[model samples]
Target: MAQAQDMIRLQDVTFAYEYGDPVLEGVSFCIPEGESRVIMGQSGSGKSTILKLLLGLYKPISGEVYIDDEPIGPCSEQHLGDVRKKMGMVFQDGALFDSLTVGENVGFYLIEHENLTIEEVEERVRQVLKVVRLEESLIDKMPEELSGGMQRRVAIARALLATAPKIMLYDEPTTGLDPESATQVLRLMHQLTRERNIATIVVTHQFLDALAIADKFILIDKGVVAFDGSLADLKDSEDKRVTSFLEPFRASLRLMEERRFV
Candidate 1:
């Protein structure tokens, strides 16, 4: 049974692509409400797969997936849709509509799904943009007019405008940006989790961003959980695979420090 605070739980989940070998095996984890969970691993290690499973985009071949404590693996499309309402996803590229104005992109969901008039949707867009620390003035601008970090925040604002989602899933939210831009994105994510009490699952290969916002760290390797614990626990892990995965991050940090002295 899931506790009241448990917002997402996966129990012994096993899954594979059609006619492909298993990508996840006997994986299990719980994400409590208001927690920041970081899923980190090398490419094709099932980190993003976990996010897909949570969103009901893919069902497990074995075991159960619970969203808000409701089992969704066997639910109907309508049921899954309902479950998705409480969840929002920020994709790797921000996934904004270039054709639409920032305001249109932010309010697109409400404009299409809800019965709200244009004025109401615009108001909702204004509120969510505020939550993401974006100005109302930028609403009329196109996505291309903003920096990479601001575009990501607009995507987040779009997600928040509709149901004020209790859960936020981010897939490589800070990839392909300057260090300053990446830090800005990470800070925005951390602020949102703290202010809104939103549960977050971030899939990334970037260690610095993970270190910035993660309360819990999960490392997946070769389709299984290699480590799962608090940030301190992760740093303390003696597991060879964990150590191996962290080598590059350590090297990067050392290089940064060395350059500071030079």
Candidate 2:
């Protein structure tokens, strides 16, 4: 069952790789259960760092981090593990094992977490592959034998294999796909989140991807939040910086739509 309040909360959190250098300064946000949030920023804007903090991979020098209102601490290994069991993450590189086949990769979590038999795992793998629109025969293929888009779908299938109420943390999910593949992945992300009511945080530079699936959006600039609101608020803002960031992409998306009609 889902919790009643925000799934994640960060309050006045600050961090740095070294002394007197700050990467995130007093960053704060609340991600409510079932909300799909997009974290947007240019390179080095600490968007990924926020994900890391939430995952308990990074510790803040000051302030607090919470998952389901339970304070997160780097030292709380057992507690953190329990909390993380409710979440799934997809990395920018897909992060599949080079030696493991697709079926082995998707079945990994089930093997580790559930005492189910091989037959059960195989059945679950097939169901998840169908969710990602991949054929059962492809499960035996090596990761290198698949196309980039196929590899990504395999990764997403693996992420969804867990039956827990999972919150997906996606880092640059569409980085290298072609236009069609990127659009397909974006649509799939939307479909999964809506159908499952899963909480999702997508970290991306692609405004278009965020626009496609986000219930709300937040912008980080130079380690601090620059904007946080709905999509309409972002588009209608008179802020020159926001306009400059959005206008070029808006024009490009319009052109892409026009070309599709011709």
Candidate 3:
């Protein structure tokens, strides 16, 4: 196993849009290399804010964000750009250009950063698409031609094209899919983390998404971390708030048992 000290680290990071209050307060955590962590929270709980902070899109008010132990605040623009190349992020909506075909979307990064010939870029795009189980025929299809699930798979394929070994940040990956499709996305995420040996952090509100994968899970509430542990530990937590939040889940299970024919 990789050493725990050298993965992604956040040191007392805090951020806020205005001076009224902080969105993330003294948040700190370390994700070991190749581990999958799910950051869960209700609305306004700062899950997405953490993603923004790590991406260096927003600066922390007090502390620092680090990838592979390099501090990530106020760095030179060129240095920050270099650091960003080591990471890949997928947004909630997949963020594909409406005009671009699936292959074009996946190859966009290579077109921008690499001096590879067209054949080389196409080969790389094909390789990553296979990782996401997208067929070659889908390459010519535009984003509008694919279903919601297919679009998300395309987004994942785009991220894998970066070939970054350290980190992949996913923001609400299972937001808009049917049950089976959502489960497929979650399982794919688990497989990708293991296969790529990359540190994966997912910020999501979907409890099912958390249960489907997540080697380590943390709960964010009211701008603070309320819990962090394995899924079994979360299921057994005695905290009233945690129990209250999970009550409906349990109740639904009992109802299912009572009405099996339904």
Candidate 4:
């Protein structure tokens, strides 16, 4: 077993956008390395805010965001840059460059930040693609040419590059995917967390997206920590917020059960 610490954390975090109402109020959570946490909530319930706080893209009003036990305070961009290298964030839309090929997208960080040669960058790109199970032949293919699911995988591959990040953050990873594609992406998320031993946090309002990966589950309601526990705890909770958010999962299961009888 890996030695686990609070690899990612938000302590008493309160945040809001400019001239806006607070999105997170007194929010607190910790995730250990080599574990996965699924952060669930209704839309606009501050799920994505937690991710941005951790990345230090947004400052909390009254608390701290930590990565690898280091607090992300008001630090220099150079310092933040180094801290961020230890984390990989995947956006909801895949976030690939439009004009860049798959390989170019994957190798972009190295190309911009490192002194690696073209051959070295290309080689590293191919290797990470393999980690995400993308074909090497897709290297030169444009992002527009790939399926949505494949694009997600490509995004994951890009995140895997530079160095294997200690923390991996996914925002609405399975939102727009079909059930089959969603499952594939979710499974790959689970596979990579185990194989790479990354501390994973997924933010999604969709219950089904979280069904496949998570060592712990956290539900945020109205900018506060509503519930945090194992799957069993989630199922057993009497909290109306948790239950309402889980209705989709329950409905999905009921549908599956009905189908089995057919």
Best by TM-score: 1
lDDT score for candidate 2 against the true structure = 0.81
Give the per-residue lDDT of model 3 (tens digit) for 80-135: 88888777899999999899999999999888889999999999998888888879
**Please, what is the whole-model Cα lDDT of each candidate in the order they appear?**
0.86, 0.81, 0.81, 0.85
**Least accurate stretch of 10 residues (summed lDDT) in model 1?**
253-262
Query: What is the TM-score of candidate 3?
Result: 0.91
Write candidate 2's Cα lDDT for 1-262 as tens digits: 2245777778889888766589999888888776788999889989998999888987898888878777887547887888887677889988899999999998889988899999999999999999988899998999999888888888888888864555788999999988778777777777777777677899998777567778888888888877878877887878776777677777665544332211
Best-first order by TM-score: 1, 4, 3, 2
65 Cα displacement, candidate 1 (Å):
0.7
Give the winner by lDDT: 1 or 3: 1
Distance from true position, residue 72, model 4, in Å? 1.1
Candidate 1 per-residue C-alpha lDDT over 48-126 given as tens digits, one digit per residue, 9 for 90 to 100: 8888999899989999999888899889999888899999899999999999999999999898899999999888888
Better candidate number, 1 or 2, judged by TM-score: 1
Candidate 1 Cα misplacement greater than 4 A, ranges: 251-262
lDDT digits (tens) for residues 93-126 of candidate 4: 9999999999999998899988999999999998
Regions more than 4 Å wrong, model 2? 1-3, 163-165, 253-262
TM-score of model 1 (CA atoms): 0.94
Give the worst 10-residue stretch by lDDT in candidate 2. 253-262
